[model samples]
Target: MKDNPLVIKLGGVLLDSRDSMKIFFDFLSTYFHNYSRNLIIVHGGGKIIDDMMKKIGMNINKINGIRVTNSSNIDIVVGALAGIANKRILSYLKRNKINFIGVSLSDGDSVLVERSKKLDFKNHTGIPKSGNPKLLFDLLSKKILPVVSSIGITKYGELMNVNADLAASALAKTLGADLILLSDVSSVLDKRGNRIDSINREKFNALINDGTIKNGMIVKVQAALDASEVLGKSVQIASWKENNEKLKLLFNGELSVGTFVYK
Candidate 1:
C-alpha cells in the first residue's frame, strides 16, 4: 500500500442502492485518478444475503451481531457477498473507468481468519486475526483499488462469513492505514439533527446516556472508536451519499465534514 493509504468500509442502506454506488464510485475515480490518492474499499452485503436466504427458505440466525454460517448456507452467503455484491461495486467502478479489483477477504490471504471463537458457529463464521498486506500492497502499487467483500476463508478451506466492519479494521491495522466507515447516515447527529464534529470515549458514553445516540448508530460509533484506538488515530464515520464531499475533506486532512471518533 501507499505510505498513507485510506480504508473505507461500506454497508447498510448504502450498499443496497445503485444510484448511491454510482455516485460513490464516481468520487473514488476522481480521487484516485484525478487527485492521485490510494484507498481500499471494504463492503458488506447483509441485506443481499438476508434476501437471498429468505428466498431460498433458509432461516437466518445470529449470535451477538455475527451471523451464523454453516454447511447448508455457506454457498448462499458467498454467492451474495463475493459474487453478487462484489460484482455490483465492480460494475460501477468499471463504468467510472477506474482500475479496480473485486475480491473477498479470503482472496490473496489478505486477511488471516479462523473460526470465530467468540461465537459458537463452528467453522463457518470467521474472526479476522491478522492481515497479510502483500497482495493489497501489490494492487495498490499498481493503482488498482481493491474492493473487498467480507467473505473469508479458514485454513481448512471453509468459506466463513466475516463481519465487514471488523474486517475493514483488521485490514487498516495491517496496512497501517486510516479508516473511514461510510453508511447512509451523514454523521452522528445531536437531538437537534446537527452533526457532532468529534466524539471521544467520554462523550460517546454521554451521548449514549442522553439518548442522542441510540440503536444501530451506537454499534457503528463503538466500532469507529475501537478502530481509532487500534490504529492510534481518529476514525471517521461519514456518509457516502453527500457526493462524497466528506471523503474529499478527509483526504484534505480536515475532520470537519464527518464525525471523527477518538479512542
Candidate 2:
C-alpha cells in the first residue's frame, strides 16, 4: 500500500464527544507532524444536522441509512454540514495548530456529483460520479490537511448531501490513498457483538446475507469494500474511542484494533 497519504472518514459521533475529539486531534496532529503523512479528513454531520432540524421543527427521514434530502432540506444540510460542522472542525484544528483547509466536495470542483441513482430518495441527494483530485493533491503535496464536509454540488449549481463514507471512498479512489473509517464502535461486530478483526469480500457478503451487519454499518462496510476493490488494498474500519497508545500501535501496524476489509 502507498503510505504517504491517508484518507480518514470521521463519523458524526466524534463531533459530539469532546474528550474523544480532544485525544483524537492531539494524537492526530502529533502523528502528522512526526510522520509527515499526507492526510485528508472527510466528516459527517448527521447528528448535528438532526439537531439543527429538530430545533427548526423540521422532520428528518432516512432511507437505508442515507438521508432523504429535498430542496428545503438541502439548505438546512448545507448550513449544518458546510457551515457549522465544517467551521467547528476548523476551529479545533486551528487551536491545535494543525495546518488544514476546510472545504466542501464542491470546492474547486473537487468532486463532480450526480443525483443518487441507487436510491430514489429525493431531489438533492447525490453520489460522487467523478472527482478532480487536483485540489486535494495540491494541498497534500504541501502538507496541508484537507478537512472536507460531505456536501457536493452538481453541474447545474445545485447543492446536494452525500454519505460521508461513500465520499471518502470516492476521494480515496481518486487519490490512491489508504482509507480509514473511524467510528464510535471498535470495529465491525458479529452477531455475538464481538469485533471481527478481518473480513474479506466473501465474508462481508455472507455477513450481510445473514443479517449480521445492518443499518449504518452496511453503508460503512460497503464503502470500505468499494475502496478496497478499486484500489487493490485493504480499508480499515477503526474506533476513535481507542486511547492514544492503541492508536499509535494501530498506526505502527503492530496491533490490529479494527476490521481490515481486504480486496
Candidate 3:
C-alpha cells in the first residue's frame, strides 16, 4: 500500500522447481492483491544459460562464477536463457492474475550502453558497463511488471551483455524503489555461515572489504551498495531455503530469517 514500488531481482534458478514456485506464486498473488505497492521484477538466467551451454557443447568458463560470454555463448544466452525465461515467468504471473509483460532491455526502448573496447576481462570483460534507467521507470509508473534482461544496446546500435545484479541496482536507484534481492542462501551469513539477519550499510561494506565476505557474494553486496548510495534505498538479501517466510517476511512483518542490507 505504499507509493514507492519494490524492485525485486528474481534469481534464475528459482524458476526450476514447480512445487516451490507454486508456493511462491501463491504468496506473491496474495501479497500484491492485498498490497497496493508497485513491484518491478527483474530476473537472471545463470542456471538456464549454463544448461544450454552444456547441451550445445559450449565450453563454460567462469571467473568467480560469472559466465565469460564470448560471441558463441552470447547467442545461446539471449535466445535460451533470456528469451525463454522471460516467457516462462510471464506465463506463471498470468495464471496468478498478476499482470505482467516480458520485455527485453531493447524491447521497451533503446537501453543505450557502452561496451568495453573488446573482450577485455582485464578491464570490464566486454560486458556493457552502463544503462538507461529511464526505461524502467517509465514502465513502472504505468503499472507494468517489466521483466528485464541484462542485455543492452548502444546508441550506434551495438548489442552487449550486462549483469542482472547491476541492472537491478540501477533501476532501483533511478525509480527509488525498495530493492529486494532473492538468493539461495539465507541472507548475508556470518563467518560461521549462519544467517546474520539485519545490519547497517557501513557494517556490511566493512565486512565485505575486510575479507569477512569474499568471492561471488561481493558482487551482490556491492550492487546493494549502489542502490543505497545512489537512491538512498535499503536492500535485503534473503534465501528461499526456509520455505514460506523466505520472501514475505521482508515485505510484511515476520521474524529474522535473512539479512537486511540497508543504508
Candidate 4:
C-alpha cells in the first residue's frame, strides 16, 4: 500500500458542482476514515481559468486540445489553478474534515518540467521531465492527502501551465501509484455513442485515426496510456458524477464502471 497510492485526477467541471462535490467529499471522508489507503488528488481548473480570462478580456487559445499558454497567461493560470482552484478544493476538504495539503508541481521540485518540445505552440507551456516523489511519500506516510494543482515551475523559476491529465500521469509514474482519471463523461464513447469499456494501445490509436476520439479526450487517453505502460497496469477513466457506492466499489477494485486503458 505504501508503494502504491491511489492518484485521482479530477476535471475542472467537478469543482462547479456544489452538490456533487459535497457527495464526493463525503465518500472520501468515509473511505479514508475506514481504510488505511494513501490518496493523492490532482485537479484541473480550465473552465475557471477560461471564465477568468473572459472577465479580463484575455483570449484563451488551444492547440490540439492543449492550452496554448504564454508568459502573458501564466500568472492568470497560476491564480486560477494554484490559487483559487487549489483553495476551493482545500475548502471542501476542510468542510468534510479531511486532512489535506494543497500543493503545486513547483512544491519541493516534485515535478521538474521543461518547455514542451513536441508542439510549437507558445512559450511557458511545459511537459514533465521528471518528478521527485519524496515529498509525496513523506506526506502520505503521515496520512496526509496532497491535493496538487497542474502548475509547474522551470529551473529558472518561471511558472508554466501543464495539462492536468499529464500532470497526474507524471505524479503517478513517479510515485508508482494507481491512477483514476475522473472526467465529466462516464467513459470514452465510440462514434456510434457507445461506451468503450476497455482499450489497448493499438485500439486507442485506431480510435484516434478514425476520428472516434478527439479534442481533450485525446489528451486524456494519451495520458492514461502513458501511465498504464509505465505502471504495467490498467488506468481507469471514470466519471466524477458516479454515485458514492459505485465510486467506492471502483476504488476498492470490486467494480468496473468506466473505460480501462491498458498497455
Candidate 5:
C-alpha cells in the first residue's frame, strides 16, 4: 500500500513531559514539511484519566490494565481522553503549525465497537469489531494529519472506553498503514532485561508463557503482533522519550532503535 499513511501511537506518559512533546512536534514538523508523507496519530491518556478521577474522588478500577469503566464514570473517561488529552496534543500540533484535525475513534465511523464481554467491567468497556477508514482516508487525501483519541461508540450509540494500543491497531488495519507504537520503553525486553531487537510469533508466545512479559506490556505486545499479522509487515515498539534525531532516524528508515515484531 504505497498510498497508505503512517500511524504513530503515543503513550500517555509522553504527554506529561514538555520536552518530550517538544521533540515529538519538532520531528513531526520537519517530516511533514520535507517528506510529504501522510501521518495519523492515535493517543492514550490513562495517566491523565487516573489523575482526574483521583481528583474527583472516583476509584481507579481496572482489570489486567483495562479500566473497569461503568456508566457512572464513563463521562469522566470521555472527558479525560477525548476532551482534555486530545486538546492538549492538538495544542502542540497547532503550535508547530501542523495541518491537523483532532478526533476520536468514534468520529467519522472510523472504528465500530461494542461492549467487551471478555471482561467483567460492570458497564461500558468496548472492543473494536470493525472499522471504516473512509473519513481518515479523506483527511489524508487532503494532507491533513489526524490526532485520534482512544474513545469509541457502539451501533446503539453507547460510549466506550477502548485500549489505545488496540485502537491504534484497528485503525492501522483499516487504513492499511504501517504502525509505530511509541511508549516509554525503548523496546521489548527479555528475561534478562535486555532489549529484544526483533521477535516473531513463536518467540513472543514463549516469552509470554515464561512470564517475561506481564502487565500493560502484555496488551501492547499483543496488539503489535496482531497488527503485524494483519498487515503482513513488522511492527515497531519504540519509545517516545527518544530525542529528535533518533525519532527522525526511525521515521526515515535510517536506523532501527526498537523491537520489531514480525508476523
Candidate 6:
C-alpha cells in the first residue's frame, strides 16, 4: 500500500451476522495486520441499534430508512455503535497481536456533526464541521487506526446524525485516503440484475435518469462525488462478503469484480 491513508466505511450489515462478523475481523487480522498504511475504520450501527431498540420494546420510527433517534436513543446508539463495536474490533486486533489503536470523535476533542458552525456552506446546504484535519493527520502519522462511529457531535454541544458513508468520504478527503466502501452487495446492479463494473459521472447520471440507480444509492453516489471532488480520486465500492480471493483481487486493483464510481 502507498503511504497515503485508507478510510474504510463499514456498514451495519457487517456487524449483523455472527459468523460473517467474525470472518470480517479475521480477514482484517490476516491481511492488514502489519500492513504499513494508515487506516480509519468508520462504522454504522443501524441494524444493530435498531435490533437492540426492538429488544427493549421501543417502537421504531424511520424516515427514509434513516432512524429517527432522540436524545435517549443517542446514548444507546453510541453505546452499541461506538462502544461495543469499537471494542470488538480492538479486541480482535489485540488477539491477533496486531499493532492497532482505537479512538473516537472525542479522542482528539473534535466534532464531525452536520449543520455545524465550523462548516462554510451557505443556506439550503449543510456540511459536517471539518474537524481539524490536523487532528486526524497526526493520528495517521503515528501509525494508529482511529475507529470512528457514525454518531457525531455538533458545534452546539449536541450529538447529531451523520452518514457513515459521507463521514468516510469526508475523512478520506481530509486524510487524502484511498477510500473503500465495503458493503453486502457486490456492486450497484442494473435493472436487469447485472453488476455495474465501472462508472463515471456521465454513466452514473444515465443510470439515475434511466431509473436503474435509486434509493439508498443516492447518498452513496453523493459521498463518492464529494470524495472525488476533494481528493482527486474515486471511491471504490466492493462486496465485503466476498471470499478472500475476490477481495484480494479488488484490493490489489485487479478489479475482477465490484463497482467503481470515479471521476
CA-lDDT, candidates in order: 0.83, 0.83, 0.67, 0.86, 0.85, 0.68
Count clashing residue pairs in model 2: 0
lDDT of 3 by residue, 1-263 (tens): 35677777877357787776677778888877776677877777777877888987888788666667666566777775468777777777888987777775555442435666745633222233324567667766676677777666655565556677666666665566667777676677788877777667688778877778888777677766665555565577776555655455565534446677666
Regions more than 4 Å wrong, model 2: 118-122, 252-255
- For the record, the alpha-carbon RMSD of candidate 2 to the native fold, in angstroms, is 2.2
Residue lDDT tens for model 1, 183-237: 8888999999999999999999999999999887887888788777778888888
Which residue runs does candidate 6 get wrong by more than 4 Å? Answer: 109-111, 116-129, 200-202, 252-256
Give the per-residue lDDT digits (tens) of candidate 4, residues 135-253: 99999988888999999988877788888887887888888878899978899999999889999989999999999999878888988898777677898999978888898777776
Lowest summed lDDT window (length 10), candidate 2: 247-256
User: Candidate 5: which stretches are off by over 4 Å?
Assistant: 1-3, 120-122, 209-211
lDDT by residue for model 5 (1-263), tens? 13457889999488888887888788788878778668899998999999999998999988777788898899999999999989999998899888899998988889888889875646888887448889999998888899999899888888998888778888888888778999889999988989999998899888889999888888788888877876778999999777778887777666789999888
Please estimate how well model 4 matches the true structure, expressed as its whole-model Cα lDDT: 0.86
Clashing residue pairs in candidate 4 are none
Output the number of the lDDT-best candidate: 4
Best TM-score among the predictions, by candidate number: 4
Candidate 3, after superposition: displacement of residue 31 in Å? 1.6
TM-score, prediction 2 = 0.91
Candidate 6: C-alpha RMSD after superposition: 4.0
Candidate 4, superposed: residue stretches over 4 Å from native: 1-3, 119-122
List candidate 3 stretches off by more than 4 Å.
109-112, 117-143, 198-212, 241-246, 252-257
State residue 167's C-alpha deviation in candidate 1, in Å.
Answer: 0.7
Distance from true location, Cα of 153 in model 3, Å: 1.8
How many clashing residue pairs appear in each of the predictions shown?
1, 0, 0, 0, 0, 0
- RMSD per prediction, one decimal? 2.3, 2.2, 3.6, 2.0, 2.1, 4.0
Error of 6 at 150 (Å): 1.8
